[model samples]
Target: MAVADLLALINEVILNWIRLHYFYWANWCGLSTCTTRYLVAMAVADLLALINEVILYWIRLHYFYWSFLAIYPVCSVNDVLRYAATDCSVWFTVAFTFDRFVAICCEKLKTKYCTGKTAAVVLATAGVLFCLKNIPRYFTQKPGTIIDNMPWLCAMVASYYTDPGWVAYDWTDTVLTPLLPFAVILLLNALTVRHIIVASRVRKGLRGESKGENRSDPEMESRRRSMVLLFTISGSFILLWMTVVVDFVYYQITGIGNNLNESQWIFTCVGYLLRNLSCCTNTFIYAVTQSKFREQVKSAVKYPLTSVLRRINKSPS
Candidate 1:
C-alpha cells in the first residue's frame, strides 16, 4: 500500500477510536488542538522515518536479509509517519517561506505587523487549511483497498494510487505548494542581491577611491555573507525538491521503473527511505550553514550548561 493510503487508514482508525471512547477529548479539542497534536505526531513520525531510512540504507548497502523481517514494522510505521509528516511539512514550509518573505520585503512594517501574535494567527490558519484539505481522504475508503491488503500488523490508510483525486492532490502538492514558495524566495533573493550590488557601487563611488580599495567594507562583507547563506539554502531547497519531482515523474510515466514485483519490498522501502532523508536534510543544512542559527543553538545549550557549572563551583567541594 502507498504511504498516503496507509495514513488515511490509520487516521480513520484513530479518529474512530477517539470518537468512540474519548468523546470528551474530541469535543474539547477544536481544530487548532487537533492540528497541534497532528503536527507533533508528524514530527515524531518523521524522526522514525529518518531512523528507518538510515537502517534500510545500511542494510541495502551491505546486502543483508537477516534484518529485513525485524525492520519491516519500522518500515511500515515509517510509511504512515511519512504521509503525516509530508502534510505537516507542506504547511510548515509555507509558513517558513511566508516568514522569509515578510522579513525580507517588509522590513519597515515588521515590528508593527509581524509580531508573535501575527505569526501564531498565520500558523493556526495554515493548520486549519491543511487539515481541511486532507480530511476528505479519511472518509473515502473501500474494503480490500490498498491499505487493507497490506500486512495486518497495524491499521493504516491505503494508497489511492489510481484515484483521480490523487492526481489533483499531486499537482497541488508537487507543483503548486513548492513552486509558490520557491518563486517568492527567488524574487526576494534577486531583489536583495540587486540592492546590495547597487549599494556597494554607490559606496565605492562616494569614497573617491578605487573599488578595490573599499572591497573590505564591513557592510559589503556582511551583505556578501548574507547573500551566500540565502543562496545556499535556496539552492538546497530547489535540489531537494527537484529529486522528488523527478521521482514522481518517473513513477507516473514509467509505472514503477524497477520491477516492483521482483523487488517489491526492498525497492518500496528504499525509495521511501531516500525521500524521508531528503526531507530531513534541510534541518542539518540550516544548522551547518547558517551562522545565526548556529549561534542560537550554541546559546540554547550553553546557557543550561553554564548554570550547572556555576552551581557546582559555588557548592562546597
Candidate 2:
C-alpha cells in the first residue's frame, strides 16, 4: 500500500475501534434510559456505517485511486452503505430533536409520543427508510474524466462519486437530511428555551404558594436532563454538519466542485472528516453527561485491568 493508503487505513481502523467500543460499552453496561433509546439506534447504525466505510476506504485506496483510474460507470456497495448510514444518522438526530421539541413545547403530545418504545420504533423505521431511500444511489456511481492530470484524480472523484443522480430523492435528501433538520432544531430549541423561561417565571410566581414544596420537581429535573442532552447532541451536530451544508449549497449555487480549487478541496476534506467524527462524539457526550454511563465505564475498565495485574503478580511469585 502507498503511504496515503497506510495512513488512511490506520486512521480509519483506530476510529472505528473507538466507535465500536463506545457502542458496545454504552449499550451493554451504561445506557439505560427511555429517552436515550435513540442513542442505542444511533450507536448501532454508526458502527455499521463506520465498518462499511472502512471497507470502502480500503477499496478506494487499492482499486480506484491506486490502479484502476480509468474505469467508468462504477457502482459500489460502499457507496450504498455510506449513503444509507449518513442518511440514517442525520434523520435519527432529526427524530430526536422532534422528540425534544414535543416534550418541551407540548406536554400532551410528549406523554403520548416520547416513550422508549416509541423511540425504538422511530429509530427502526428510520433505519429501514434510509436503507430503502439510498437504494437508488447503488447505481449512481460512474467514473468521470474530470482531472486526468492530477496524481490520483482526487478532486474529480470527490465530485463524481457524489453525483448520485440529482433526482427528486437526491434533492430531498440534500434539503431535509441536514438543512431542514438544522432549521427545525434551531426553531424548536428557541421555542423550548422560551417555554423553559416562561415556566421558570411561573414557578417564581407560585413561590409563595409552594413555599412548603421543594423547588426541584422531579418532572422539571427530567426536563433539565433532557435539555442538557439535547443541547450537547445538537451542538456537535451543528458544528460538524455546518460544513456539509455549506459545501452542498455552494455546489448547488456555483457547480464548481468538480474542479475545486485547492482550498475548496481542503474544505471538503475537513467537512467529511468532521462528519465521520460525528459518529464517535455521541458516545463521549453520553459519558460526559450521564453518571450511570461514567460509572459503568469505570467499572468495566478497572475490573479487567485489576484482574490482569493480579494474574501478573501471581505468575511472578
Number of backbone-clashing residue pairs for each candidate, in the order shown: 8, 0
How much lDDT does each candidate structure score? 0.52, 0.70
TM-scores, one per candidate: 0.54, 0.71
Q: Per-residue CA lDDT of candidate 1, range 103-130, in tens?
A: 4446687566545566557666765565
Estimate the TM-score for candidate 1: 0.54
For candidate 1, the lDDT comes to 0.52
Worst 10 residues of 1 by lDDT: 23-32
Best by lDDT: 2
lDDT tens digits by residue: candidate 2, 181-203: 79988887888888987886676
